[model samples]
Target: MFFIICVVLLLCYFYMRPTVPRSPSCLVGKTAVVTGANSGIGYQTVLNLASRGCKIIMADVADMEKSKLDIIEFTNNPNIFAKHLDLSSLKSVRDFASEILKSEDKLDILINNAGIGTAKNNRTADGLHPVMQINYFGHFLLTHLLIGLLKKSPSGRILFTSSLVAFTNNLSLKTLNFDLEKPNYFDRHFVYGNSKLSMIMAADIFAKKLKGTGVTVNSVHPWLVKTPLFTKIHAIYKNVFFQMYIWLSQCVFGRDPWEGSQGLVHAAVSRKLKNATGKFFGDYAPWRKPLKAYNKQFCKEIWDASEIYVGLTPEERL
Candidate 1:
């Protein structure tokens, strides 16, 4: 009877402990830039970082005037500002980078969190698949353009928003280029998955390349959070499988945007993670990889392929 009572009390204590969420303190003088910050994961991440005293730069495709107001309202910090960025266009990325270079010389954090999932059969101004362009290549060029600024920070961190779909996507040399003649129409989830896989591979290669530069790169699975990106897909497609997925998301797997942003925040600010580089993380710790992420030949292939697809030669940073 005594032991049973003790176990019951322990269970009650464990259940009623009122777990405290992770809310780290002030960044003070540091600067953080989050892409797609108008809503969803990006917006929450911006606020979370701002709460810690980091000067926040919010970049997105939305109207800057309204977004600025919203961010100001959300953060109530004068340090928060919005920049117009359309990641679909490489030129837009270049122009945004140029503007940022003129304004801020150093960036402590670069969260490549802006992306599109499955969009219609369209191409960017750069003549690439809209999904691949916005999701991977755009972030690719943007990161390179800002590498100089990120490197200026004492312990710079670059975070990529990868997805579990990365494992589900089909990737091939042919698909990397939008080969219309290939007889395969886009599978929205698969394309998104491929882009995410590329992102993970890119993050790994990027961290390896920047080995001595004090810049750390990591990719994250933010889990299934409800965001506007899903609404863009066709209803018929959404009905087949995505609806059920979203339902499951609502029931069990989904997180609020704020909760989803925690892993990114932890990666950005935690001193404990200073040495944790060139890896994937989720749920706020070094991800338990089913297999080791490092494969010299595969990594090299991905780097080389990405470089080709983005029109970047090995010698060129942009």
Candidate 2:
């Protein structure tokens, strides 16, 4: 069919899209931390930074020993280390930050890259929505805690792995409730979108807060790579043929993970972006603006609400 032919052609084009070459700039003494660094975009981004001689902390819920060893062997970067960070729990996030602050003198890059495609409509023990907690609020707290350490570096950068799904997140303050209180709906897809949108909103707010502090804030969308989370979510419906079709489409059309990570790599390390802040990298040209960003009053309200939800004390407020 003509439609099928066109679909195949489109897949070929995405498959052929050019990859941003790895940066030649070195990060010899700089320290960077990436969550969800065991796999997907986080894994590839860590590899890219490791190749640049950066000391990397692979923070995730997974057992990070093997992943750290693999990167160490491949890049011959001895400074790569693994650290446990379970973003679903606020205590885990705080503990991770505490460990980092006590051990590392400074942090140059912090990529809030850990995220989930679906969270099964659950709530974290902190009484926050699971996807929102893992995708946005957990990073929210982590960044707030590590901000001083980031400021300790001569040039610091924070990057959030937002998603294109943000464009569809038509969220209001009530629906954005972290605790899933009464009158709040729990649509998994929309929550994911809302979380991504929240991330960009945080970047915009942080860019303003960190102004003139030598730290830059940005967010990136790692365009539809071959992640299995959403697929599993839909497969729960038990549709046999549709599941096969899903696998086929992803196999034939998904961007390779390494190529998908280039925009993040560029955002995290490229010298050209040293002064770039409060921006979105929708792709490798590495710049786009989300619709909800820059609305100062609205964003400020969201930030204030987030501070309360995450239980940040007066002293921890940025």
Candidate 3:
């Protein structure tokens, strides 16, 4: 009887997991830019949007030729273009934005999807924690630089690929940087969670600042996804038991890249959420309530601190 009950529960869990719906709206003539487009959910998102007739810009440090080819062939949309964006490098972010500003007159969607989860402590060329730089600060700077172009559009949407970990961690606004001096400071999971939380907070602040500008900003926790990010975790833990656990968990609960990307696509193109801004989405729908840790004051502090970390000038502060 116990075994039968357990099996029944497992079946129900799998049956109830939300699936991404095909976007009903057409995106002909719309323009979208997705970071980390070379692989994972970003690559899947590019394919979906491209198929709907949206011109796409694939930005990542990885060689995007294969992804570009696949998207072009699968969607038969030749407008897919690639731009080199190394989210860990502030210089690279600026360079990519400059190029986009010069070439593209209109921007409809900006998906800040590139992220890293490193077990080791490392710093980027910008002198900040690598995971924090790639996950939050870099996208923060990129959005600031591209706001002018986004404003030119009739309606612009900004989507951040956040994680469930965001809700599980508390951010220390005083030290966005991990304390290398402390023995417990090198907790990579905590560091990564903090960065993700910051991204969600930043999205909320941006939504308020850009109110009535016809541009909206929101964040989504793409379900437990099977992507290269986990490969990094496996590389960190060489234990056979740990590796086996990862494999088992992925086999049981992980969503494919396409399934994981549904929430992001839904956030970007769904007519129902056209005016929804500063909201958290999960399973292609909004959370019933706001996160308890979401404080407007703390969000402002994060915004100011991030501006300084990224070297934004007073004039550039938005």
Candidate achieving the largest TM-score: 3
Q: Candidate 2, after superposition: displacement of residue 138 in Å?
A: 0.2
Query: TM-scores for all candidates?
Result: 0.86, 0.91, 0.93
lDDT: the better of candidates 1 and 3: 3
* Cα lDDT of model 3 by residue, 1-318, tens digit: 999967875886597477766668799989999999999999999999999999999999999998899899999999999999998889999999999999999999999999987736566767888888989999999999999999999999999999887766647775577656332423666787888888888888889999999999999999778999988887887679878988866766788898898899999999988999989898877773236336667777778889989988776677
lDDT (Cα, tens digit) per residue for candidate 2, span 187-291? 656888889999999998899899999999999887777755556655553557756765766665567778778888888888888999988887656555556
In candidate 3, residue 245 scores what lDDT? 82
Candidate 1 TM-score to native? 0.86
Candidate 1 Cα misplacement greater than 4 A, ranges: 1-23, 180-186, 234-242, 288-293, 313-315
Task: Give RMSD (Å) of candidate 3 vs. truth.
Answer: 2.3
When sorted by TM-score, best at the front, the candidate numbers are: 3, 2, 1
List of clashing residue pairs for candidate 1: none
Q: Using lDDT, give the best candidate's number.
A: 3
CA lDDT of 114 in candidate 3?
Answer: 95
TM for candidate 3 is 0.93
Better of 2 and 3 by TM-score: 3
The 10-residue segment with the lowest total lDDT in model 1: 12-21
Residue clash pairs of candidate 3: none
